[model samples]
Target: MFTTKIIAVILCCLLVSSNGLQPSTCSNQGDGNYGCFDIASQGSCTEVSNQPASRDIRWPHSGIDSNIDWAIKCGDIIAYKIQWFSGGWSGWYVPGVNDMDTKVNNGNGLRRMWSYFYDHTHSYIICKTNDSNKLRGCQ
Candidate 1:
């Protein structure tokens, strides 16, 4: 049983890393109020506002997903496009891994990020969610 559990965990981790899909800083926290998602510089590359890691939580009015809001990296155009296409996530998300598909609810965040790489491959991206929650947005 121990071995099986270990193997299962390893497989899960493998699947998650298969596409370099980094999980959210805070795993599916109900509403950022409890713990807002923070965008990072390593993975899910995002736009920056004033200083590094000092982006405003209120970018626009609010993401279309519920009351969840998205704080784009200051002026990252790709970030804006991704959010525009995916409706902006209050937290980090990946398609074909954590998310069921990459066509619904804007599951292309990871894909777009990964595909946006100069060589069509990115190490990671940064996504920060202030008052966003509800995993229903993805798989």
Candidate 2:
């Protein structure tokens, strides 16, 4: 029974750690900084400045411009800020909000906003960050 309890505890810890239950210790690079990770390599970090300067919006529709290419994937944890044409910013959506508000809210609104941004009707990509520098991406 003792052995089983120990194994259970160990499994729980592993599961929590893998799910980002632990805090991230990665260092911040300040504003206007970008961290790069090789498309082929994993567990490494670098800096890249070649990201797109601005994204075009189609107005009636919401989505990113077809010409623009996103470096990260859908499930990939990344940082982004919400911009409005009226001249306002919504702050960085780290972990895409769903991961952040897992327990508090259902994250339905955040998910919708993200979908709108992805569709390209809103604003452009101002800045972004990833988790290459830390154990996980965009923690």
What does the lDDT read for residue 46 in candidate 2?
A: 32
Model 2: lDDT of residue 134 = 34
lDDT of 2 at 18: 81
lDDT of the candidates, in the order given: 0.34, 0.39
**For this target, which candidate reaches the highest TM-score against the unseen true structure?**
2
Best by lDDT, which number?
2
lDDT of 2 by residue, 1-139 (tens): 9999999999999898786232344334556233343354344323332233233342113232221223332133244444445556655554434323222223332222444353332322333333543334334
Report the C-alpha lDDT of model 1 over 20-137, residue by residue, as the tens digit.
3334553544443334444533323354332222133332222232222222322113222123234332233343234222443344222232222222112223353333431333
TM-score of each: 0.16, 0.27
Per-candidate clashes, comma-separated:
15, 11
**lDDT comparing candidate 1 with the true structure:** 0.34
Model 2 TM-score relative to the real fold = 0.27
Root-mean-square deviation (CA) per prediction: 20.0, 15.0
